[model samples]
Target: MKQTGAIVSVADVAWIIALWVNRSIHSSMKTLKWLLNLDFEQQMNETEKIKRAKQIAIIAGVFTAFVGVLLLLNYLQIKKSDPLNSLVLEKLVERLSSEPNNQQFVEEIRQVDLLMRKAYFTSLWQVRTGAYLMLLGAIVLVLSLRVYYGLRFAIDQPSADQIKEKKKRQLTQRWIGISGALVIILAIMSAFFTMNHLRSYEPEKMIVHSKAGDESIEQLEIVSIRTSETEIDTVIITESTDVEVKQPEVAITQQPEMVVFNEETVKINHNAFRGSWGNAVSSSTNLPTSWDGATGKNILWKTELPIHGYNSPVIWNEKLFLSSANTSKRVVYCYDRNSGKLLWEREVNNIQGSPATQPKTTEDTGLAAPTLTVDGEKVFAIFGNGDIIAFDLNGNRVWAINLGVPDNHYGHSSSLLTWEKKLFIQYDTHSGSKVMALSTETGKTIWETVRTNDVSWASPILAKVDGKFQLIMLANPNLSGYDINTGKQLWSVDCMSGEVGPSPVYGGGLVYATNEYARMVAVNPKTGEKVWEDNYYLPEVSSPAYHNRYIYIATTFAVVACFEAATGKFLWEFDAKNSFYSSPMIAEGKVWVFDTGGKAYIFESGSEPKLISSPELGEKVFATPVFADGRVYIRGVKHLYCIGVN
Candidate 1:
């Protein structure tokens, strides 16, 4: 059947070509029949034949001249305005580098460039083609004028035979005129087909390129040192060091022996801002009950940061990681948690393009809005440009990959999370929203679930319900839950609206969802049912925190409110000193909320509005503070401060 179809297609194409050729031959024969006739002198007198030939030539020459002039003018217009420029070519190169593994993109780029070059050459040659046609028409007109004059100057007059030939000559002129019009029409049809063929070379879609202009990177170099060696093991320190020549290695023993390496297991504290659910707060431990950054009452150390971002810091072991970026560069900063000293800085080049190739952003949303994730082994960070990079504890880059440019309107703010060695990235965009699970050891995707949401800023939180772990997130008009291991939608409910910023908080057999201009709904994860919803005092930016039977919320306008977890009942509202962008945190029977004006408000967690103490940290704060051990790490616009009693 396939072979039959192939044969049939070839036969059809051959028939089309043959038909066009036959038409062209017939038209040509009719156009030049009078000139090729050998018996013209016997059939018609010279005077009569000349008169008829001049009329035919004059009409054909005028028609051909008009076509030639039209083609010449079109060619000149094309030369004046060409679309291919350096900027356009540069964008194509950038798009090529973005997805080097995509073969389709590579082929499309090649075809686009080839077509553009072909168009330039075709327009240039059209000028010469038109000029040649004009010259031919001019020669024909001159010959017609010569024939008219020679016939009129003859002295001998014609007889009755000449009078009869004059009528025949006039009839032949009508046939030639009909043939000339058809010839001109055929030329136009051929040109039309040629242009149609050229149009087939257009790309499937326009590919725009972006640049990370004037960006400078600071690549951190790390060195390893073997400090001591025992009989069976060695201790090594992975730290940043300068370039220095090393001595030759010396063997400790010459005899071959069996060695048993001891495997040690260490327990890590929940210190980082693990997803949107917040770090596990200790109920009985002694964290700082009160602190003041302006008076230096409990401020341990403050280190200034060069870059600016709203991304919160993540802590693993003894290091605190935070990501920041400008329009040109994205940077990850690692600092010593105890001393607030800068340990190492790693930078990645950024390309800023939004839903379209135009850089879409607002003053509030920046490049590094997503918080970093540290899963004990590697620290992962993602930028608005769809770059996901991972690094080990020693500041060495593990792997990097671009998840295709996101189509978010106000930058991507979906924070990353990890469960059982799989990195979960909530990549919700305006056009192609997906939940991807990647292998932590290698930056390879394990499974991906496409979503129908449009442009959400909420991050996903890991929740355990009905003896299985589920990833819960707030999307446009819905609060959905998915299986953590497999990208399967376990449950979802329509309970959210507007641009979602506050991630869902899971507790007490219910998950609470909130947004800027939407109702706050508490959803049951098992059945995907909305328990209760309220529209009063909805948070625009800050996420809700659940403690005991109450939920705490900090509005964007600096009003701190608490509500009943099970029922949609408003508890109380307090006016915070400044506006809040950071989410509220509950730890040790107190609710901690940071405002935009560098102030931290501490209050008792209850239905009544009671303000305990408001401490002012001199710098502007946009990130949520991390509380672990005895220190609270707050990431300000210009610094990362460790507030603890020394």
Candidate 2:
């Protein structure tokens, strides 16, 4: 077992020795006074006094020797039972077994091990305060004894002057030692605080300005504009005060009008067809309304999905895969991406629990929230019940495993990620969450690490930092990184405070993460150190999408904010008419975001954004958009839209 607490450690032996030395000196002084005041002038010989002095010195020497040995033993015990080394050994065994041929893997493992040891060792200094208190108590006890004995025995002695002077000197030395020790202790604490603060650096300040001019800022007026196909009108009103202005009237002039014959006309424009959805504050790709026969729009064969699902489709080669579930059955469906035809469906009765009132209670509530991932040969999907199923490209079941029963207030929402031969998933719930890694070939557990706090809806992402790969998860109260091979926690930064939803995005050498009630944070992924944090509250379910050097975040309050990825700086904000749950997807230099009201808003994916188009599908949408082979597939509550050039 590791060290129980910081208190009562091996290094305390030095403190004990110092206390013993002080007590011995005081005892020696007391013994000398007793010997001198025993009528020694008339009855005692010179040799007797010399013998008593020698005895007192011998006693002090023996006491000091005993304290020195105790101190040595304590140090030896601490070295032998170091808990940091033991934990490192456990992690090293797992890493070696997973990647036996990696050249620098062993060295990287050693470095991580050393860092953990240092952290634990540094914690020991916090216990030093208790040791100092013990030393102080010992000093006080020694001084009290010395003062009482000196006054009691030397009341009528002729050499009292000499004894008093010696006492005074000892008192002065004691005060100096106490003061110096306190100063050293405080200095050590201050240095530790300063170093820790410097390591966690904050970014520079940001300034935002309002659109209205300074003269009109005091009485800021909001104008509402209504438009039709032929005309546009605007109206303005102020709540604080009202002012009336005169309107100019002009006489109408009569002009000759020409009569036109009605004819059917077809107008086609590439740029005019791109529309936007979700909260239209962010930018998206321009989707074509039609495409050519082989790879484009209206000419290709189309097919319908077997059942309703919120999960987006995954396409590989010409085949498409998706997961879905109904009241009595859970299934994996395979389809043809070009023809939109269902090829095969695999159904199973894997669910065994009753549904709760909340929409996110179980995987059966919706089989398709967690999208399926393909690693060329096999397709993988994770159910809310912790069921992980794998299927080959030809629709054959390869393997399956259930991690655990996820009992979250809102069911499991994490998607599965694969690295090499391992499948990683974050299973954070109310009943104690954990990040688990499994062998992809057999679905056997590799390693599992318990999360520090409860998690709700966030997913984990794999990120490479400083040439090392780490699996990062945004759990409640913190963003944690773990060794991808061994599931050992490498580093954790406490930046998120509320329910975390956004899957972490890694770009530009920094890992970006945000929580529903907390702010967005950027950190150096390798060291798990915070670079900057901005107090921007977003929705509980929306995830940030990154493109170039910008990040687009959609809040539940119907606002989409664009931010610079490396530094936590807000660039622009857009106001959509409805709240958002669907995440934004970036493609073709634009952002496509869908809202619950079935409106798709397309925006320019740059610093200065402009609205491209707005199209209404007249349905509710909860899933994000997916793009493949120049076609965008959006799943609505009642229909799946295939947008491309016609």
CA error at residue 165 for candidate 1, angstroms: 50
Clash numbers, per candidate: 0, 24
lDDT of 2 by residue, 501-585 (tens): 6677776777878877678888887767899888765666777777788888777788878888778778888888787777876
Return the number of clashes found in candidate 2: 24
For candidate 1, write residues 272-369 as lDDT tens digits: 34333343343324567566777888889988888888888887667889988877668898898897888888885431222223245676888888
TM-score of decoy 1: 0.60
User: lDDT of each prediction vs. the true structure?
Assistant: 0.67, 0.58
Off by over 4 Å in 1: 1-284, 350-358
